[model samples]
Target: MDWMMLGIVLVLVFTVGFVFAPLGLGGGMLFVPILHYIAGWPISGELILTCLMLTGVVSWGSGLVHRREGLMDESIVKIALRGAIP
Candidate 1:
């Protein structure tokens, strides 16, 4: 993998995170395409998996703050996690 392209993709993901996080979204929709098309990464499982992990991290960051502020409901979260995890 080209390190320079990877760095650019990371920066773009971080910047997109700011926009999407506010709306309670992960950057996967943008991330996968950015990595595949812009970064010239080939379409493969690893590319999609990378997008998944990156988006998961981005979403987790905002979720953490919301949880700390008690803006999240534990019961609903548990239900969602049950389905999501499986």
Candidate 2:
């Protein structure tokens, strides 16, 4: 990818993370559509994968910070994890 395109993508990703982190919103939904439709990026497997991974990483990072700050409920997290596991 060109430097400019890479820079734009990075900025957009950071912006999405910044806006959604505190709200505990998943940016994958918005990121894919914005990048593909608004930013004119091609809708492809690679793009989708990258968006998913980025969303996971950002969400995890935010969750970690909140957890460390004692904002998260361990019991709720345990229950959610149990339900999420098949």
Per-residue lDDT of candidate 2, residues 18-84 (tens digit): 8898888858878897678656789899889988888888899999999999999999999999987
Among all windows of 10 consecutive residues in model 2, the one with the lowest summed lDDT is 32-41
lDDT of 1 at 6: 78
Off by over 4 Å in 2: 38-40
lDDT of 1 by residue, 1-86 (tens): 57888788778888999889867888779988898888888999999899999888889998998999999999999989888985
Predict model 1's lDDT versus the native.
Answer: 0.87
For each candidate in the order shown, give its overall lDDT on alpha carbons.
0.87, 0.85
Give the Å shift of residue 78 in candidate 2. 0.7
RMSD of each: 1.8, 2.0
TM-score of candidate 2 against the unseen true structure: 0.81
In model 1, the runs with Cα more than 4 Å from the true position are 1-6
